[model samples]
Target: MNALQLSGLITAVATAGIVVIGLPLAWLLARRSFPGDVVFETLILLPLVLPPSVVGYYLLIALGDAGPLTSAGVHLLFTWQGAALASTVVGLPLMVKSAKAAIASVDPALENAARVCGSGEWEVFSRITLPLAQRGIAAGTVLGAARAFGEFGATLMVAGSIPGRTQTMPLAIYDAVQAGRYGDAHSLVLLTSVLAFFSLLAVARLEQAGATTPAHGAPAGGV
Candidate 1:
């Protein structure tokens, strides 16, 4: 696949990973304060503060031939899947932070009311919490996707830049620059800029719409 196609694929995979893993974690952190919760959250947010190359180095070791995953017959080294994994790691913090804030903003009374109506945990989360917090979750997901799409350092370490193989848009741009393909580099830069602009614009719109929307009372007719 071309760089654009490869980036989309990687972003999709990474985003799915983020949503599946990050959202629940976010909810737990937002709602429950247990012992060692601070430490646990710090570990989760480590990648955000650490250098990308450092994160990449750790991933490379973990995914390399002698790594535990390889011992388990799961090979991710130098593959697009590896790239997606890197993206997921780096993007997770943003998703968790944004989603946690959004979920926390929701009134706990509404959720309590749902439970009072005999709603199960899943029902309360799905019918009440999720609807009210959808915009924030969406914004977080979009930001995570954008970060994944533009990933470079960690992706490069785990998934080498092989054109039409594992080369994502960022890697393609790097290759272009090193080869003195200025025109190609310029085009890729513009493409990235356009994508980033649109992603931020979408996030802003979602936030604005959420802010303008009126808060509702307890769900009618029971959950």
Candidate 2:
């Protein structure tokens, strides 16, 4: 595939992976309050407020060939995977925060009722809480994916602007501008903006639909 296509694929995969992992972690954190819970939440949400380039720099230090992950024989720098890593790090906080909010919005009493009905912990969560929170989780996942797709600074710092290799849409646009390829840059920018806009629109529609859907006969606001 072309560089743009490859980058898009990598971003999507990485974003999906992060959301999949972060959502469950968010659920755990939201559902169970423990010592240092607030601290854990802050750490999970750290990337949201940090500079993207800073996050990429740290990832490079941790996952580069000569970094701490060297022993694992994984090389992330200047590769599409590196871009994916950067995207994941940058998008993780959004995913976790949205997911945590969604999970938290779920009514604990519903879960408790499920438990009293002899449902196992897994059953209660999967059947009651998960369905109730699916809308939020889906919305969060979409937001995280969009964030990853738009990431520029971090992906550039970690993955470099290697065309047809590590160059994502954002990086491609930047490179085009640097080389004075105004037409190319404009096209890329327009494309990215359109994609992002549609994504947000889709998310809004999903949220509205979710809001209107009956919560399986549960009390209003139970979700």
Candidate 3:
């Protein structure tokens, strides 16, 4: 695939992975308050507050060929998959936090109502709770995708900006700048900015729509 297409694929895969893992974790954190929950939340969010380079460095030590992961024959550094891994790690916190907020916004009464109606826990979550919070999850997915697309420092440290391979749009832009290819860098920056802006706008619109929609009685799945 071309550079742009490959980067798009990477972002999609990373976002999907983050959503799949982070959503359930977010639900657990949001719905089931427990001891050390705050600590666990903070740990999940560390990547957001920490420097990307620091996260990348740690990933490298864990996943690089010469690192401990090598003993298990798991190599991640300097590959496209490594870039996706870095993106997923950095994006996961955002996804989790957004998902948690979304879940929190869902009324407990709705869930209780479903439970009272003989809905199982899984049924209530899949049918009632998830639909109610779908907007938030959608917003989270968009935000996570945008973050992944723009990720640079960590991806660079672990994946090295190899054009048509490991180089994503952000990395490509940086490389263009470093090479004094101002026009190319400017084009890429503008393109990325536009895409990020539109994705955020779409999420905001979804959130608004969700807020405006009235809740109905439980369907087959409780939603």
Candidate 4:
């Protein structure tokens, strides 16, 4: 596939998985504090702070041919799935952090009220907490999707920059530059930039929309 098609597919696939895993993880962090919470949160946020190369190196070891997963015969090197997995790792923290803040801002009293009104734990969360925090969660999801689109270093290390299968937008740009195809590189850069710019704009808009909500009040219909 060309860069445009490959990028879209990679972003869509990785983002879908990230949201599925991220939302509930975010909720867990927001609503409860378990043993080792800080430690787990720290691990999640490490990719944000650590050098991309460092993260890539670890992933390479974990998933490479000589890696433990390979020992179990689960090889992912030089594959689109590996690329998506790498992107998912980097994007997951943004989703979790953003969604956690959003969910935490929801009115605790509203949740209590829901419980008092015979809503089960799951029902209270599904009907009350999730809806109330959805704006922020949506924004976070966009941000995470954007992060996946920009995956390069770690993805390159783990997935390799194969032209059709593993070459995501950022990897394509890198390849263009390395091959001295300046025009192609420029085009790819512009394409990725435009996409990223709009995604970030959506994130900002979502955050702004979420800001209009009252921290202490329930939504209009019911708690």
Candidate 5:
């Protein structure tokens, strides 16, 4: 596949990975305060503060030939899957942080009411918490997908720039620039910029909706 198609696929996989991992973790952080909470959260969010190249180097070591996954006979080195993994790692912090804030904003009393009505934990979450917090979670998801779409340094280190395989848009742009293909580089950059702009705009609109919509009030039909 070409760079655009490859990026879309990687972003989809990365988004799914983050949602599976991040949602439960975000709920735990927002609902419970355990020992070492700060440490655990900081570690989860470290990629946000760390340099992308540094993050990529760490992934390279972990996914390389002699890595633990190799010991388990599950090789991902220099593959498109490796690029998606890198994107997932880097995008997780945004997902968790945004989701946590949204979950925490939900009133505990509302949850208690659901339990009083004989709702199970899963029912309460699905019927009450999720609906209330959907906007912020959506915003986080958009931001995470955006980050995954434009990922470069980490994906380069772990997956390498193999054309038609793992060469995502950012990597393709880098190669174009390096090969003195300014036209290709310019077009790719413009495309990436447009995607990023829309992603942020979506997030902003979600945030505005969340702010204006009352947290304590139920939706029109009620859950």
Candidate 6:
């Protein structure tokens, strides 16, 4: 149960980070065309295709006592923070992908019109673009949260199974299974399935809403 609480905390933190990092990035990817943009995007999306253990392994090297982060006195290995970091890495791509699609669905003419009406870039984004893109942003966050909740390999590599401290739901379930505690595993599995079902449902609804978003201003005058 403590591990489950930790998983909830980690999921919340990691998903929040995903939103903070993903929102601007999504906008950039959807609207910009800079040199090496494709490379940047590919890097962001790489974790989606990469093995979870592989990501965890690198995170270990980067967060280990002898690694750069530890060398700089930022110890995270075998801690809840380390687990959250790993979860963030795995979940970030989902958030960015959804956010990008959502932001892209917004009509450019609305932004241009707002700018022409004396709205600063930031103001236009905050008032018009962000509001219009809210559905996608929210969907991406839910997906990120779901991914973080189920993170196992990367969390294991970064934080290990430290009982009530760093061990999350997935890690706890693994431990129960390895200990031949089938009953415990079965209960955990049921809980996990319930959570996953709701999360997936949210993703589907949000994605559909985002995908079907009409052009900004359609309700008013049609962009």
Q: Residues 126-203, candidate 4, lDDT per residue (tens digit)?
A: 999988888878988898899988988888888888888888888888888888999999988898889889998888
User: Of the candidates numbered 4 and 6, which has the greater lDDT value?
Assistant: 6
Off by over 4 Å in 3: 66-68, 211-223
Best by TM-score: 5
State each model's CA lDDT, in order: 0.92, 0.83, 0.87, 0.86, 0.93, 0.89
Backbone collision tally, model 1: 0
Query: What's model 1's TM-score?
Result: 0.95
What TM-score, computed on C-alpha atoms, does each candidate reach?
0.95, 0.91, 0.90, 0.92, 0.96, 0.93
Highest lDDT scorer: 5
Off by over 4 Å in 6: 211-213, 216-223
After TM-score superposition, what is the CA distance of residue 209 in candidate 1 from its true location, in Å?
Answer: 1.5
Clashes of each: 0, 0, 1, 0, 0, 0
**Candidate 1 ranges beyond 4 A from true positions:** 214-223
Candidates, ranked, TM-score:
5, 1, 6, 4, 2, 3
Model 2 earns a TM-score of 0.91
- Candidates sorted by lDDT, best first: 5, 1, 6, 3, 4, 2
Full-model lDDT, candidate 5: 0.93
Write one digit per residue (lDDT tens) for candidate 2, span 1-223: 6656976798788777887788778888988888998998888788898888788888878877678767688777888888887888778887888788888888899999999999998999889988888888888888888998888898888888888888888888878898999999888888888989998997898788777776556466653
> Of 1 and 3, which scores higher on lDDT?
1
Residue 202 in candidate 6, Cα distance off native in Å = 1.4
Candidate 4 or 5, higher lDDT?
5
lDDT, candidate 3, 98-209, per-residue tens = 8999898788998999999999999999998897788888888889988988888999999998888898888888788899999998888888888988998998898777
Cα lDDT for residue 151, candidate 3:
87
Tens-digit lDDT track for model 1 on 1-223? Answer: 9999999999999999999998999899988999999999999999988999999999999999889999999999888999999999999998999899888989999999999999999999999888888888999999999999989999999999989879999999999999999999999999999999999999999988777765664346522
